[model samples]
Target: MDNRDAVSAFLRSRRERITPEQAGLPVYGQRRVPGLRRGEVAALAGVSVEYYTRLERGNLKGVSDSVLDALAQALRLDDTERMYLYDLARAAGPAPRARARQREVRPAVRPSVARIVEGMPELPAFVMNNRLDTLAANSLGRSLYSQMYADSTCGANVARFAFLEPAARRFYADWERMARFAVGALRIEAGKNPYDRELSNLIGELSTRSDDFRVMWGSHDVHVFRESTKRLNHPLVGVLELDQETLSLPDETGLSVVVYSAPPGTAAEDSLKLLASWSATTGQDQHTESASEPSDRHL
Candidate 1:
């Protein structure tokens, strides 16, 4: 999982997606490729062809911020894509600095964070890492994603569940759209943390196990999860159209708290109330079952 390969693929993908006309460049006769040629992009960015060629070859080392900005402008990169490009360049810096940037991302949730999630009894809230692992979840959050939790194969990873679980298709109303967003988000994380072994393994596993993931991963799209509406078909509570908000922790832990809520006076709101009640009842039953288990001495 060399970062060079990622850099090369991302640049080429972005380049090949744009046409000369899109970039307001005059097209020459019989263009071999659909996108603006390297020279055209270089000219647009006010860089020499050789320099842009060197960048496209994945050697972003010692790249300047102004040049990166110029490239981003020439490529028409959106905010998220621009951030990803900057991250890739930073990762391409000196070995010691890059290593310093690669800090160990702890998967454990802080007690205060867990308490905050638990305190939000009305909303389904969970804490997740950059890898899309649901590290901690409130009772309602767990209930909301019961299908994902039931399938132990993904180990509570959202990306894995979306790609690897068959039930996911039925669980999400807009399966294809959600899957693409998930893929895009994962791609962004990969760009930020290229040295993470767990993330690499997760991407490799998804690529190997799911054809849809493999195809979507090839697009080189990027996304940052902020706020979105998710239409979910829960087995227990039926349809739930919830608005999800992702808030990043202030620290460099790469952890975020995702909270889902429904608008008042909507059917989704009614469903959430019912789901909360059901979650409470089920949780009590599980607690009772644990308490009633026979002791080792008795056995």
Candidate 2:
């Protein structure tokens, strides 16, 4: 969780996976290792071997933004990977100038947003934070995630459920895919707000409790949950395949609303209709998830 450990692990993992040939460098007959060496990456990034070695050794304090970008490029980082690199560097480098606090999520639940969800009664929709905390859900959204409300604790966190609850694994047919998305989203948040006390504690608890979470976290496979396909199991309506659209609130920080829909005439579409019906009959409920899952798994 420290910058030093995060930097060392992230770079080492990325470097170990990329081959010299893939970077278009000559593999030559005598090469033994699979990926580019430290010196090789340093050369590609236009930095001295000694400096790059220092960087890899957890000495990222005072590293320049340009240098970080160079390393990201040399490593052939994707959007998520590149962002994570910068986040780590930012965390380790010089103290940031104090500025206004950016919550990044609209705290107010807009009436218009609720109206929109109400209009699409058949679709399952809800709002969540960068930290994956559920803020609001429409009627159908409540039914779609009925299991989440099976408990008395009016509030529950999804990440806690995904890793700690066995039912979550069973609930999500595509458990592994969902889990990866969860990890990726969490990674992005970690980079965005490294010092968030709750987040830090959550990560710490998970790291101690879930081996799988820790492994993926260490790998630093940062990702954004902009859009995704999901498979959900419903008690009354069976299973559904829904296409989801996640819209970030431009007016707020860390808040985004997601809606899940199925094309007309599909069974999933019909299932969604059933969810709405169920919600109309049964009042909305609350969910309490197991928040003590371990977060340790080798990435």
Candidate 3:
């Protein structure tokens, strides 16, 4: 995607969301526009109309940090939104550098990282990277996402599974909220690593294929997904309400482990214990049935 287009669209969208009343500008009468006029924003930002217009038109190269801050203040942008504005400016700047690209996930897993996941069998835990590739998962974690894991071709793509896959609609209890969180997380990831080729491709594909994804993506919203509460339906274990946390791996770039657990005495917690028991009994039954079955030669 062209950085200029991204910058322009993002700024325009943010600008359109605000009203003169919100910005403390008096709305004299019925206006032709939805948001503050160019001159009004410039005046509030302490910049000339021409300069502000240029910036909004995607000319952010060589812009001063102070001016960017002032513009951010004028727009009443939040911390994430302000950071996203700066990210776009830096990406569009003349002293250009390739943004971080997430191509293929590193093939080899860190042994210690795997061990940590294995140690937490009671907790559904897995590792993913900036590109939302699910790198590693414990047995319980795998079970928790059996709907996703059942498909061998899932290939660790969270966005695809979350939105494109039909099963996901039933799996996630709060589908709309999950979609928002997914798109917002992706936006944050893009700003953090503007040149991520894999991420860019995923975004492009989603934009082309899904109208819902396209609309949300165009909003330029960003959110850090460090923690969340999720409600999921598991075929074997039934529904579970889980709280999840994403923990960064200091030694690995763009890598984080996500773990989910339910509080004790909750229905979800009980369901997990029952699932464990059922899995053990199912394993034993399978083994016993295998013993009774005839071999190929006998057949």
Candidate 4:
């Protein structure tokens, strides 16, 4: 998708969410649209209606930071939305020379990184790149997301599992909300890395295959990942209310570690322990099977 269209759609979506009353504007006549009129937005931003109209029509190139800030204030955008606006603006600018390097998908994970995930035995932790590809995960992490790993065709893609796999509907308690959040996170990543071919392809595939994904993607929402509570209906351990913490790996750009945990003495914590036990048993069985296999040299 073109950056200009993204910019226009994002701004329009933000504008359409705020009513005149919410914007502290006096309601006058019958409103034709749901939110504040273009003129009202321009007035609130202290800009000309024509200029704001141009901006809303996908012309954000060369726009000053001050004007953007004013527009953001008028729209009452939060920090995440404001950052997304900046990302879209940067994307609309001249293409960078290093974009080709940035577009490379599936960067190799360092052994140390994998070890770090493995070290966190109690918590279900996994490392994923910006494209939401699961590069490395602990045993419990793998167990927690067993459904995603069940189908090799999907690989370790959280987005594909969420939208394409039927198990996702059963795994995530709030399936629709999780789906929207996943798409929004992907949208944010797309704005930051427009040249990412893999991300583009994934978006295309999801849009083509899932009608719900297509509709949510069309909304142009953006989300910044942070700590959140998730309710998972695990097939083995039943329900679990886990808290998620997403930590960025500074050395590895575009990669982050997501760890899931529950409070002490909670039923969720007991469920997590049960899950860990199951994972341990499963791992031992797999290890034994691999060890029992006859070596080619012996044969």
Among these predictions, the greatest TM-score belongs to 1
Residue 34 alpha-carbon offset, candidate 3, angstroms: 1.0
Question: Candidates ranked by TM-score, best first?
Answer: 1, 4, 3, 2
Location of the lowest summed lDDT over 10 successive residues in candidate 2: 286-295
> Could you tell me which 10 consecutive residues in candidate 1 have the lowest summed lDDT?
290-299
- lDDT of every predicted structure (CA atoms): 0.80, 0.72, 0.73, 0.80
TM-score, per-candidate, Cα-based: 0.90, 0.84, 0.86, 0.89
Residue-wise lDDT of candidate 4 within 10-51, one digit each (tens)? Answer: 888889999999999898879889898899999999999999
- How does model 1 score by TM-score? 0.90
Clashing pairs in 1: none
Compared with the true structure, what per-residue lDDT tens digits does model 1 show for residues 51-156? 9999999989999999999999999999999999999998787674455345443545667787888888779887877777776777788788877776442227
Regions of model 2 farther than 4 Å from truth: 28-34, 93-120, 285-299
Q: 245 in model 4: Cα distance from truth in Å?
A: 1.6
Off by over 4 Å in 3: 94-108, 153-155, 278-299
lDDT of 4 at 217: 97
Over 4 Å off, model 4: 153-155, 284-299
Ordered by lDDT, highest first, the candidates read: 4, 1, 3, 2
**Best prediction by lDDT:** 4
Native-structure RMSD, model 3: 7.3
Global Cα RMSD, each model: 5.8, 4.9, 7.3, 5.9
Residues 1-299 of candidate 3 have per-residue lDDT tens digits of 45777777777877888899899988787999878888988999999999999988988888989999999999898998898888877776543333333324353447778788767867877877666667677767767776666653222566767777788888889887788878988887776555666677788878887888898887787776645788999888778998888888888877788899898889999988776566555552111010111111100
